[model samples]
Structure formats: structure tokens, C-alpha cells
Target: MKRRRGSGLSETQLGYLMVMPALLLVILITIWPVMLSFHNSLFDYRLNDPTRSEKITSSNILMESYADNHYYLEGAIDNAASSTENEEAAAEVEQFAEQYNSYHEELMSFDGVEETFTTVEEMLAGFENINDNELEYVEVDNEFAEEYKAFLEDSAESLGTYVEEGNEDGLENLQSYVNSSANSILESNFVGFENYIDYFQDSRMWASMSNTMIFTVASVFFELVIGLMVALLINRSFKGRGLVRASVLIPWAIPTAVSAMMWSYLYDGQSGIIAHYFEQLGFISDTSQLLSTGGGAMFSIIFADVWKTTPYMALLLLAGLQTIPSDMYEAAQVDGANRWQQFLKVTLPLLKSAILVALLFRTLDAFRVFDLIYVLTGGGPANSTESISVYAYKVLFAQQNFGEGSTLSVIVFLTIALLSVLFIKLIGSDLFDSRTPRK
Candidate 1:
């Protein structure tokens, strides 16, 4: 006599429901940042530029700047006008002030603007800095901003002329104030895809991308070859194998920045043992060439990267080597296959998945190489080793150009994404093919 229970979700639906939280977390962590970077890339955002500091879709007035400038502007203009003995010059100055006053009056008439302006004026009188949420950046009609900017520019020019000819007392300061006030009235900085277009045409961007490709390809290639050999060597049962395995991981275990710093000293022209040896071996004409020339710098970074990460690659491949059944190798030997033939037929085929995974990880890491190159070569020696990541960091932080930097960031993301897709496709096909049930 109990009521019948309704059916719950199907197995597939329940499975999806269980994973929804994790799926949302992954999206928030990965997709949100990429989307934010794309959004920033569409505008002319820069910290050094007050007008374009924030992403603006319409004309706006920075009330803090407007209030501060207006306070000084009125006094400057009045004093200059009163000081001029020439009736004509005085009358013209008065007319300019009147026009400016009318514009100010109109701006103050906007909703919430007058209230914010009054608050800012009060703060200024008290010599107090405006705190967050206390001041408001009021948006206005684009036409109005243009007109006000034009009027301020004209007023500044007239003031400059009056001051230069000694027609008015100290009008130069007033001219500067007027100019600053004009700048406070910002125009829409949003220029969709303009940053992207500019980067495509930029020579430095292409150069950085080329450097990234070269570093990625060379470093990953060497790591794969050397790592395979190391993995093969360590896979066999031998005395002190545990110690050897632990020793191999020392370089990989060191922090990248610290490793780079250590290598920087080793590559130093005057004191480094590696550089001295390279010189003695006739690889270079002088020890200094190791880090002071384009080829040498590229080689140095690749060598350092291979040395540090080869152990990691070996570890991954070693895991695959461990998974192979001992019987497979014994069976190959019983079939009259030599060691080399057995390795070619059995080891390589079984190790494919691990190799693919290692290559994918190493390739991505090398492509985004920044900290190592940044700390060591500093993208110097004529920027021959500057990776795209380093270039983006310089633009984003050093120059404070967020818009262009965001464009660079997006490009890096896209390139990494393309590489990931390529690797996944290759790996996915092999894995699925291998795991498919035999007919």
C-alpha cells in the first residue's frame, strides 16, 4: 500500500550528474581565464594611460581627476584674467572661462554626477584622497565627451598663446591644467581584435614565436632520445639500481629558477667550467660565446633543459617498461630473436603510449619556457632566446600594456591548445586501437 517511487535518472545521466561539480570546476579554472584574456585583448587597456586604464565601452569622466583639475583650473584662469592689463586679452580670457563654466554646468547636470562631484570637491578641500567606492566614474554621451574635449583643447591652446607672448601672467600652468582635465574625459577604448591584428603584423612577436618553436622542438627531441636510452639502461636489474634512479632525479628535483641560476654561472665566460671546456674543445673561439651569441645561447638553453628534464621523461618511459610482462621478452628470445630485434619488436611497441605522453608533456613545457630563459639569459644577447612566454610577461608586467599582452597570452594559449589537440588525437587513436577487443 506504499506509493510507487518515480524512476531516477538513467545510468549515463547519473554518471554525468556525479561529475557536474568537477566539470564546472575545470571550466572555471581553465575557460574563465582564457575568456578574460580575450576580453582584455579587445580593448586598449594600459595602466600607464589614465584614459585607457580600464576597459570602457562608452565615454566616461574620471570624477576624481575632473574635480581636482577643476579646483585648480578656476583659480588659475581667474588670476590670469585679472593680471592682464590689456582689455582685449582680459575680455577673451573671461569669454573662455565662461564657455568652460557652461560645459561644467552641463556635466554636473547628469544624474549622480553632481552628487559625486560635490563629494570629491569636499574631499579635495580637506586634502583627503578619494577612497574606493567613495568616488564614481560617470559615463556620459560620446558626443558630449568629444565636444568637451575639443573645447578644453581650444582653451589650452589659447592660454598657451597668451602666456608665451607675456600677454597674461602665468597662464602656462593654467594651460597644463586644462590639458589634464581634457585627458580625464576618456573616449571609448574598446577596439575589438585590433590588438590581435597588430600582433600578427609585429616583427618581435614573430621572432618570439620562432624562438619558442625552436626551443620546444630541439629540447623535446633531445630529451626523448636521451630519456629512452636512460630508461632502457635503468630498466634492467643491476646492483645499486635504486641509488642510480634516485641520483638521476636530482637535476629534475631542483627548482627551475634555481637550476637556471646555477646554469647561468656555469655558462659564464670568465669562471664557468662548462664554458672553459667548450672553449678548450674548440666548440667556440672564446668561452664568452656560450651565452653571448645567438646560436650558443640557444644551444645552452636546450642543453640545460634536456639535462634537467630527461630524468622526468625517463621516469615516465620506465613506468611503461615496468608494465611490459617479462614473458614477452622471454618468448621473443626463445623465438631466436636477438636483443636488438626483441627491443625493436616488443619494447618499442609496448612503450608507445608512455612515449607519447612524455613527449606531449615535455613539448608543452618547453614551448612555455620562461622562468629558465628569463633568469638565465634574460632574453638578451639581442633577444635571440626570448620565448613567447617571456615576451608576454615583459609586455604585460614591465611595460604595463595589458591589451597587447593579453593578445600575446591568447596566442600562446591557442598554440598550446593546437599542440594538445594534435597529441590527443594521435594518442587517442593508438590507445583505442590497442584496447579494442579482438574479433
Candidate 2:
């Protein structure tokens, strides 16, 4: 009988199937957002206001409506005041006529000036004849008369001036005023790319790039060194080795945001234990604020990064360490090789693949570091800690300059791609060669 083919899978197919879900998730979460961000960078997007919206257009209309209402209401109030003054003047004239009539009758009834009537006595008698209501009426009339005289004088002067000028330029002046107002309104409607250009040309970009490079290179280098040492030490048999390894991983297990926040407190100038201890040891001045200075801030960020990531580097190296054979070390020792010589010749040569892999992973991660620096310093003290990631974020989110933000992001992406390609060409292929099986 012919044997049936079983449902057995090849190692490569099995491995691919196992990673497919993770690969799909990576594309969905990381790659998709990056692609979306790139697309948005092409557009000049404003988050605060929707583009081409009816509400924005309506705002202009509402402003115009208010301006029109203000002008018309002011004109109406002035015209009403003028009409009231004219009515008051007409009433005053009528009152004057009534007073003149009464005076004339009194004068006619009296004998001639020689008929024993003194001027002072006649004035006092006329005042007494005026009733309280009539006196109040006369007082109000006089106030209006004074105000009307001033108004007429001012109006006459203005009218005379206008007549002398012949009002020849009034239409041209009005048209020019309207044209300027229209230009201002149009200017408000159109936005410019000056901010984008300024952001690209500024020294802030280069400064941030330099600081970021230093941070990434230094932190990755030291973290690798220390992590390799720790991994090597723990790779050997020891009591409670599992507990020690687990303890070391605690730093890495803590979230980056939480770790950064914890470090910020530890670096606090006033009451921080680290600061106080360092000061007591004379490592730094007592008055020193770690985050206040550029160098100190850089150091603080690097320290935080190493503290959080060293365990991760060690874990990677430890995985590689487990693959190495103990026979190689035993053989090297039988050849009269000391520990240092054995490490240099046997251990280091074997650990090259692990070191390169760890370096590559850590370097890329460090290059894109933002959380630690952001939480600790917020790119403060004159943007001393402003990485390319932070700069891109500020342009895209804070300034809402998506176009320029995209430009910066493209630059960063290109740089990372070039570095990755170069690194792979130099050492990555050999380091990850699967054809050569380890002993």
C-alpha cells in the first residue's frame, strides 16, 4: 500500500506562520500611522479650524454685519440728538415770545419813565411776577440756548472749511479707504508659508539634530558595554541567578513614561536623593540643578535611557550567550589562557553577532527617543534636549505646520534607512547568517 503524505510543516513555513500575526500588527500600528503622517505632511492642515468651512465664512459675514449695525446706530443716535436740539430751540423761541408779551403789557399799563417808577423797583416787581414753574422753564431754556449756539458755531466752521476746499478729493479718499480695507480683509483670508521656511532654515534644527545624535550614540554605546558585562556575569552558574536576572529586568519592565517620570523626580534640584548624594560627594555643586544646564540635561537623559534599556540589551546578549558552547571556554582555558585573554579571543569573537544585533536594535530605538527627554525636560532650557522626533512633533502638532513637519520626518526616515542599509552591508549579513550553524 502507498503511504499517505502527512500534514507536516517545514521549519521555515512554521516560523513564518508564527510571526505573521505579529508582522500584521506591526504594520497596522506602527507602519500605518507613519504612512498617514507622511500623507498629512503634504497638506497645510489647521487643527483649530476646519478648512473651507461655512462657520469660518460666516464669521466674516457676522463681522461685517456688526460693523454695519455700529455705523448705522451711531448715525441714528446723532441725528436724533440733533432733532431734539432743534425742537428745544423752537420751544425756547415760543417761551421768549410769551415773556415779551407780558413785559410789553406791563410797560404799556405803567406811566412814562417820569411817573415815579425807579428801574430797580420795576425789575424786582417783574421777578416776583414770574412763577416757580416758569423760572425752572427759563433756566432749562437758557442751557439749551448755550449748547445750540456752540453747535451752530462748530457746524458753520466745518461747513465753511468744506466749501473752501470744494470737497474735490472726498470721493477719491473714500475709495482709497475702501480699497485698503478690502486689501486687509483679503490678506486675512490667505495664509503664507513663511513659518515653514523659517523652521527649516533655523539653527534650532541643526542643534537638535546634533544633540540627538550625541544622546543616541553615547547612550547606546555605554548601555551595550554595561549590558554585555552584566549578561556575561549572569550567564555563569550562581546562587539565585534567576532572581538576579529577574531583578535586573525590573527597570526594562517599567514603562518608559513611568521610568522617565521617576528619573525626573530623582534629578529634582531641591530634595532629590541623587542630587543630594552627588552634592555631598562633591561630584557637583550644591546649587546645581541637573535639568537647568544643557550638559546636565543631556547627561540626565542619557542616564535615564541607559538605566531603562540596559536590561533589554543584556537580555538580547543573554539569549545569544546561551547559544555559545561551554566547550569553547574550557578548551581555551586548557591552553593556559587567562580570563582576560580568553574573553578577548574566545568570548568576544563569539559575542560579535549578539553585540551587533543589540547595537542595531538599541541604536535605532535611541535615535527615535522622545518619551524620556520629553517627560524629563520637555526639550526645555533652550531646547537642549530637542531631538528630531520632538522637533517633528512640535511642527506637526504644536505649530500645526504639517508640511514642514513632514519634511523633517522625511529627512529622519531617509537617514534611518541609509544607516540601516549601511549597517547591514557592513556587518548585519554576516551576523545573522543562518547557513552557518553555531557549535
Candidate 3:
């Protein structure tokens, strides 16, 4: 008997196939980036250095550099030899070329590298861009690569001084030409695990991590407290409850950047209402001290973040609140439970999942806090307020150190992952089980 095309598949298999697209999308978008970042963290990748701009794990020869520089070097040597016209100078040029040729031959001896090298040279001579990366670059043995690089650098320097002494005044440019020739054949920039080691040794990195933790803990704690109060207040059936609920969300609805800028103005030491009030209220000894002192700046950051994001916490908790049946509260009321007792016995026990969700989100959000601290404190007062995200941004973009920045990024990802696991474990499997739909 002929079977239908899909008859062999089970219902579970069909369900898996149906969801595979979304799972693949998540892996492609989220997991792939993190894996790329992890890969980048292995080497000393930098953007400013032409040779190291890309992530190269293996020993690679920079053929374009060798080709262009060798061409110039050969021409410069000939020009210096001819212009000098002295037997001793000619002998010197011969000696320099002999040593360079020796190393050059060894480099070319690698199978197929000679062909690529010649092609690159021809393209360079024609003023054509070396579009084919493989042609412009080739693999070399790690040991040979290092030896060749060191040899070129030494020869470029020594030949510069030697040729300058024996050449004519008109040939002064030959020395510079020879010296710069070494730049064409760049060495392997791969420094495996060095970036991580350096970051571990770095005090600034640890300090930034510390600051991130402080901000996350402080902001999340305050937000949870204030948000819970707001959630409870709005959860009640009072007059104009709709208006109150809408008003409560105003702070969270504003864009983060706009909120940060607004707080920046409000935190201004001079002629700012919030700062002026804080000074009068004795929160600070002086108004001008808010942004100037390290502790004060950290305080200002937490205050700003809490104010800007607490409404979001309230909103999450409110969703959780709505899920709990009113009968739970009514049962506690019938048992002669007070509002506080009812909340502790019925609300909190049931709201554990909601709390976990809110804390996980807010904690991660606070851990990665950038724009708020960036706009407010600018990680100032001697970088005392510098969060890990800000530090990563400074290293990745400001310093153009992609390898180290990627390491920092991986650290942030791992930290968030660890926190997520912690939250899930503490909340237990029941939290998720409770979220499942009824059959």
C-alpha cells in the first residue's frame, strides 16, 4: 500500500518541525553573535593595525606587504648601488641584497606562496587593488613566520644605516625606503588567551565590574521596593484607578536616552531643581558635589535609573498580580486576614514567579546599564562610576581593541547567563510548570 507523504511523522515530531524555524532564528540571531564574540576573544584583534584588523587564528603571510615592499626594496637597492658608483658601496648593497634574498627565497619556498607573492607583486605594480584575499595573503609556518618577520625588521634597520653611509647624498631616501620595507610583510598577530589574562590583571576591568554590580544591586533593590508599592496601590479597586495606572507608567514609557538626558539636567550641580532640593533636604552637603564626588555620582546614577525604570517593574508585577484569582484574597479575608497578612500569606506566595521575572529583567538591565550612566556621570569622578558596558564601549570603539572588547562582551554574557540560572534555580521548576496552559 502507498503511504501518504507525511504519514510516518508523529504529532510530537510535527510540533518540533513547526517550532524549528523559530528555534533556528534564535540560534542564528542570538547564539551566533555570542559564538562570534567568543571566537574573537581568543586573539589580540585590533582595528588600527592593518595586519590585525581581521581575526586570524592561523599563521598567515601578508603577501601584499611583502610584494609592495620587496618591489620598492629591490628598486631602492639598485638605485642606491648605481648612484653610489663606489666599489665599497656596491659591495655593501650586494651584501644587503644577499641577506634579503636569502630570507626572501626561504619565504618563497613554501608551496604555492611564490605564485601568490608574484601575483600580488604584479597587481601592486599595476596599481590594481588586491581584491582576492587568498592571493594577497598565504599561510606560513608559525616558527618561520616569526623568524622571517624578525629578519626583515633587522635587515630594514641595519641596511638603512649601512646604505645611508655608503650611498650618495641624492640617495638619502633609500634609507627610509629600506626601513619601511619591513612593514609590508606583517607577522601573525595571534596572541591566544592573552587578552583574557590582561583583563584579569587589569584593575580597571575589575573596578568597572564592581561598579556594574553596585549599580545593578542598588537600582534593582530600590526599584523592587518602590515598584511593589506602586503595584499594590494600583492593584486596588479605587476611584480613577485607570488614570492612576496610566500615570504610573509615564516614567517607564519615556525613551531611556531621553530619560537619561532629563536626569542629567536634573542632576546638574548648578541651577538644577533636583540638586537644589537635595542640598536643602541634606542628601548632599553641597549642590555642586553631586556630579563631582565619586560616591555622589554613583548615588545619582542609581537614583536616576531607579526613577526611570521602576514603573516598568510595577507593570510586570501588575501583570503577575492580575493572574492571581481574587478568590485567593477573598479566602484570606474570610479567614480574618488583614491587608498586610493577606499580602504575605496569599499574594507573595503566589507572586514568586512574577517577582523572579521582574528581578531577572531589571537585574540584567541594570547590569548592562550604559546610556543612563553615560549621559549622567559619564563614568566620571576618576572613572568611579564606569560600568562594564561603558568600559566595553570605550575599549571596543574608543580604543579600537576588538579582541579585549569581545572578551568583555563574553564576560557580560556569562554574567547574565549565571544570573539567569540563579534566578531560575531559586524560583524553582514550579514557576515554569505553573505557566503551562491547561489541556
Which number leads on TM-score?
A: 1
lDDT of 2 by residue, 97-210 (tens): 354345324433433421222332343445543233222111112233334334333433432343344442332232233222222111112224444466568798888888
For model 1, residues 406-438, the per-residue Cα lDDT tens digits are 999999999999989987886645755666567
Local distance difference test, per candidate?
0.89, 0.65, 0.83
Model 1 residue runs over 4 Å out of place are 1-7, 81-102, 105-135, 154-169, 426-428, 434-439
TM-score, structure 1 vs. true: 0.88
Cα error of candidate 3 at position 31, Å: 0.7
Cα miss at 127, model 2 (Å)? 66
TM-score of each: 0.88, 0.63, 0.86
Error of 2 at 106 (Å): 79
Tens-place lDDT digits, model 3, residues 33-148: 99998888887899987768887766777677767767777888788778776676567677878877888888889999888988887788789998787887788887877776
Candidates sorted by TM-score, descending order?
1, 3, 2
Error of 3 at 384 (Å): 1.3
Q: Model 1 scores what on Cα lDDT?
A: 0.89
Best by lDDT: 1
